[model samples]
Target: MTTSWWTFGLQTVNFLILVWLLSHFFWRPVAAVIERRRQMARDLLDQAQADRDAAAQALEEARRRSAGFEEEREKILAEAWREASEARSAALVQAEAEIATLREQSRTAIAQEEEEAARVWTARAGELALTVAARLAARLDGAAVTETFLRWLTDKIAALPADVRSTLGAAGEVEIVSAAPLEPGLQRRVGAEIGAALGASLSFSYRIEPDLIAGLELRTPHLSVRNSWRADLTQILAEINHDERI
Candidate 1:
């Protein structure tokens, strides 16, 4: 076998040219594409980590806001309860004061009514007594009654002190009031009896008053002697009224 040196050398040169072409075109471009893809993946992973941290911070802030809102609600409720209690106490005090005032007014009104009733009953009793005395006096003998009253007057004057009798006689006139007119003889007798008791001469005046109710009244300027049924009945009624009031 005859070996050709030139042919071997030409083949070696062609292989070297093909190697340069593949390195400059297909190999360099494929390596560049792979490197760019790796860089993009790293950027995406960093962005995902930042997003997770921001989400955790937002959740913590939301929890703090919720706690503050709950505390504010509790404080407002306590204040409202305190205000309501104070208002209730004030209303009760006012109501009690009003009740006390009303009770006092009622007591005063009751006392006044009792006093008025007592006065009315006393007036009625006095009128009834007066009527009964007048009727009894009408049934009696006027002359006999007048004589008895004159005798009583004479006795009363006799019982008086000497100084009192002298004072009564110094009035210059002795008035004799009766329910009916006296006869001239009876009048003269009464005058003599009174003069004997007083130990002095006195001017006499006889007068008729139907209201005397079968009795006599001897009057002086500063002294009077009443011996009459009407006057006795009035005194009794006054005593009874005073006792009832007590």
Candidate 2:
């Protein structure tokens, strides 16, 4: 083959020019674009990593808040249960106190009723005793009983205090009350006996009082001497009533 040095030099020169042009324009611009794209991709990757860390922190905070809420709910439930128990205990104590009060009142009422019944029976008994005494005294009224009562009246007048006896004697007239009318003979005898006992002569007036039952009573304007079964029965009834009260 015949060698061509000029052609070879010319071809070599063209290839060097082409290489410089590509390095200055196409290669430089393409390499710069690729480098910029790579930098953008790295920036995106860094941003994604930061976002993941922030999201994880937020999730942890949410979990902590949830746990706090659960603890608060338990506390509220326990406090409510404690209050309810206290209320129940207080109600039970009140109910028992009321029941005890009612029972005491009932007992007091029953005791009062029993006492009232006993008092009523005692009063009735006292009345019956007085009635029986009065009837028996009435049956015993007679001439012998009259004579006996006249002796008793004379003795009663004799036994009086000196001042009382003097006052009775000083009175111009003395009244004699009896259960029945006296015979004229008996009246004279009775008046003589009374005058002898007083040591002074006095006027005598007679009166009938059936309520005396079986004895005599002497009466003046300001004085009364009761020596009779009726008076005795009245004293007994009063004593019975007083005893019942005690």
Candidate 3:
């Protein structure tokens, strides 16, 4: 190598100039651009974080509102169910009361109907008994029955009170009523017996009544004495009717 101090010194000076130029222009500009880009990236990250926080807060608020709505709906449904149950119970109670009332009414009606039926049957039995007695008594109308009744009449007249006998004797005439027509001889005997019993000689008139049913009756304007099967049957029927009423 040929040593050249002049060439070496010149080269060294040019290198120094180049180094200063690069430091002042290129390096400074590139460092400023990088710093600016880093600042912008930090600002963008801060904005994104803020937006995410706000979105999370909104989601929590929506969840709280949904829970409140669900609770309200449940409360309304429970209230409606309770009201329906109360209504059903009231209806059942009313229906039961009505059924009991109807049953009581029916029982009362049945008892009344039974009482009426018994009364009607009792009346029918009384009528049947009276009819039987009347039919049987109708067969006993005969001379023997008449003669017996005449003797009883004489006895009855003989036992009369003093005032009754006086009243009979003072009457215009005695009416002799019988179930059958008497013979003239019997009539004379009956008049004699009656007049003897009354201790008076009395005129007499005769009349026949078949309804006496085998007995005799003494009648005046104000007094009547009945001794007949028909009268006995009638009295018996009246007593039976009185007992039933009691």
Candidate 4:
């Protein structure tokens, strides 16, 4: 193999020149493009992160507003319920008062009606008793009733005090009234018996009064005595009616 030192030198020089040209031209432009692409990607990533933070803040604000609105609604509903309850209680109280008033009025009216009824019944009973007594008295025998009253009168005069009897004895005259005319024999007997009982001579005069309803009456100027069915019945009816009222 023959040695070629010059050709080897020339090949080495050409390789060195090619390497410097590629480093100055192709390598520098490619490095610059790659650096520009990397810078753009970093800017996009930072912008995306900022947008995400803004969206998160907005969502939080909306949630807080919604919570506040819910609280306000609940407060309003509670106030409305309280007002309704108070109104219902007031209405109930008013209704109860009205009912009590009505009951009192009814009781008063009933009491008044009962009192009126009792009064009417009492009056009717008095009238009926008076009617019955008048009918019974109408059927009595006038002469017999008069005789009985005369006997009673004689006994009453006999039982008088000594002073009263003496005063009667001193009177000028006595009067006897009857429902019917008495027989002359009966009149003489009555005058004689009464004068004997009083131990004094007395003058007597008899008068007839048909309204006496079967009874007798004795009278002097200072004193009078009546024993008649009509008078007795009137007093009895008055006493009965007074008791009923009580």
Residue by residue across 41-138, what tens digits does model 4's lDDT show? Answer: 87777777778888888888888888878888888788888888888888888878887888888888887777567667665665565566556666
lDDT digits (tens) for residues 79-122 of candidate 2: 88888888888888887888888888888887777767776766
The Cα error of candidate 1 at residue 54, in Å, is 20
State the TM-score for model 1. Answer: 0.58
lDDT of 2 at 22: 96
Off by over 4 Å in 3: 1-141
- Across 43-142, the per-residue lDDT of candidate 1 in tens digits comes to 7777777777777777777777777777877887788878877777877787788777777777777776776677677777676776777887778877
How are the candidates ranked when ordered by TM-score, highest leading? 1, 2, 3, 4
* Model 4 Cα RMSD, 1 decimal: 13.4
Q: Positional deviation of 126 in candidate 1, in angstroms?
A: 1.6
RMSD (Å) of each candidate, 1 decimal: 9.2, 8.6, 12.3, 13.4
Q: List the residue pairs that clash in candidate 2.
A: none
Which candidate number maximizes TM-score? 1
- Report lDDT per candidate: 0.80, 0.81, 0.75, 0.77
Once fitted onto the true fold, the runs of candidate 1 whose alpha carbons sit more than 4 angstroms away are 1-109
Q: Which ten contiguous residues of candidate 3 have the minimum total lDDT?
A: 125-134
The TM-scores, one per candidate, come to: 0.58, 0.50, 0.45, 0.44
Candidate 4 — which pairs collide?
none
